[model samples]
Target: MFKIMIVEDDHKIREIMLENIKKWGFDGLYIEDFNEVFNVFLKYEPHLVLMDINLPSFDGFHWCNKIRALSKVPIVFISSRDTNMDIIMAMNMGGDDFVQKPFSIEVLMAKVNAILRRTYSYSNVETDVIEHDGAVLNLKDSNLIYNEKKLELTKNEFKIIYLLMKNSGKVVSRDKIMRSLWEDESFVDDNTLTVNINRLRKKLAGIGLSEFIETKKGQGYIII
Candidate 1:
């Protein structure tokens, strides 16, 4: 069974989520000390994490970055902050998905199940590496290599680049990319995708692979 860590502060919300997580046959771990969020994560080493933006000591973004630095464990942000900037910041901070408060438990569980399946089950058959234009995407470690230099990618960045590199020389539509990245793409903001792509391009450029991913306006994105 997959272990899921809950980093939410509210007592009522945490209990609700805990009940449903157990109902789904997954072990749920909740944090009691906000200051030791990362420490708890290290001790538990959960397969996935459910985080909320408004916490006690540090915001969710800070903890997200701390966890992201060491592990690529799937993280979903659950919060009432519905602003575009909040969503974008969550994505930028390395969250795998975002759920607004007042959300249906059923929908949240669906997203959780979808992400877990994609992360664990689908990975069983995927090749460890994908190469294009002399740049190699290391699937196992989520690093991109080119000219002997390697750069680690965030979860979203890895998925976006992996999709583009897999369909190298082909125009991948925006809808397609969004679906590939977020299983339930309808809840995702359009600008969120742009933010991920731009961040990815900037990272690629850092390794001297400037213009590695091109924008094919009116269509989508391409890597050629």
Candidate 2:
């Protein structure tokens, strides 16, 4: 089932939308901390979002732009404002659709289904989630989750983790990691690879998974 995030602040409206969302067979998430809206969004990684324009801290446009930076997940603006300017801003800020306020649950679900079908029907790729030692690496969004703690990872950090995890019990040489990262060892910088490894290790440690990636003096690194 597709996950939908509701970013509305109004308690009544949020509850109503969530109820209808469940009836449509979708997992609905409601935001609690308005200050960390984007952070919560990254943690859930919902397929789509129903955002309200007027929010507590920052408005919907601000959060829409923030989500755009992270993923291509669809975001639909639902607000009482129906001005052309509001609609245009929503689209420009990466909103896939704009639903005016006071909409029927039937109409809302219709729009939601249409967008889901149009976007996901032609896309057959599934997001891969790799789990090891209580840590899950979300390949779809490049975020690491450990014991309920979420950490957003960079592209290289993700690639390094992927390589190591694929060969869990084996030692992956530094050169092999560099080759895997760039596909060309000659173009790889020795220092750059070390820096990325250290950063990746630090991030893992931050989530209480210290020494998750074990480094061998003469050999290389291993996750064992």
Candidate 3:
């Protein structure tokens, strides 16, 4: 099922949209920390977003611009401030569509499904493999291919590597890394995360991609 990110801070609207999203056979994730909305976007990698114009920290336009930098995902703005200027501004800010406040959940769902169908139905496929130097990560199958060798990875290992490769050239802090790994409860200490990172690196180096990841002092780890 496709995942939808709900950035509406209003409790009632958020629940309405979430319920309809599930009913429509899509997954839903509600934003908890408005300050780290972009982080949520990266971690969830939702196919689309339902956003409100006003929010706790940053507005929908600001988050839209940031998301556009990382993804081509669709965004639909939901708000009570309905006006020509609001619609115009929303579109200019990279939003795909807009829904005024007090909308029927049915109508909202229709718009959401239509936008997703349009976006995904006509796009050319990106290369399944991401390559650097001679090493490649087969995104389709979670396999590492390098120097005439293929390395298999567990689900957790694949997720770790995917995050590293996706954000290559930047140090990913331990907290962020752990958040991606463990979405709730079960706190993973820094030492355990380090061990897993080491194991993953060795698996990569066993074939050819040694020095694939680097430890940034007091920062975190990164693959570059």
Candidate 4:
């Protein structure tokens, strides 16, 4: 299922949109802390974003620019302001579409589904690079670039860092990491995974990302 992130601040509207989004068989994600919108977007990596014009701290346009610098994911503006300038600004800010407030949920869903189909139907939507905290993972080259230094990674190291960076604020368990490696035909056992993690950490530290990935006791590892 496609994941959609809702960035509206109104409690009632946000909940309502989420309910309908889930009802339509899509995974809906939202955040209450508006200040962390960009970080949350990076962490979740939603396929599309429903953004609002007015927000706490920074506005939707600010976050849209921030995200646009990183990924080409679709962003649809949903707002109470429907002026010509607002719509133009939304488009200029990299929004794929705009839906004004007091709008039909069905219509919104239809637009969302249409955009998703058009965006993902005939192409791979993953970005060429995944970046966090100044470290850029070049998917095409399997190189980790930090502070103008590039470090080549083995297949297993790439996969491990990809998973960790993709899920940046969450703990990824050892079993999950092992499963991912196994799917890639690496066949890493528990001890092997530990070794890989250690090696990857050392490489990251070498490139000025020391202590980037943290161990979470018995749970797993997290890149926060």
Model 2 Cα lDDT, one tens digit per residue, 1-224:
89999999989989999998887678998998899899999888898899999999899999998888878998889999989999999999999988887765545665676578668883552324555655767667888777668889889999999889768899999988988788777876789999999999999999998989998998899998
Q: Write the per-residue lDDT of candidate 4 for residues 125-207, one digit (tens) a residue.
A: 33456666557777789998775688899999999999999899999998888888886535555789989999999988898
lDDT of candidate 3 over 5-97, digit per residue (tens): 999999888988888788666899899889999999999999999999999978999999999888889999999997899999999988898
Best by TM-score: 1
Question: lDDT score of model 3?
Answer: 0.81
**Off by more than 4 A, model 4:** 122-224
lDDT of 4: 0.86
**Top lDDT hit:** 1
Q: Report the C-alpha lDDT of model 1 over 71-189, residue by residue, as the tens digit.
A: 99999999999999999999998999998887766557666776887789855433445666557776779988776688999999998998998898999999999998888999999
Question: Candidate 1 — worst ten consecutive residues by lDDT sum?
Answer: 122-131
Model 1, residue pairs in steric clash: none
Candidates' lDDT values, in order?
A: 0.88, 0.84, 0.81, 0.86
Scored by Cα lDDT, where does model 2 land?
Answer: 0.84
Candidate 4, residue 168: CA error in Å? Answer: 42
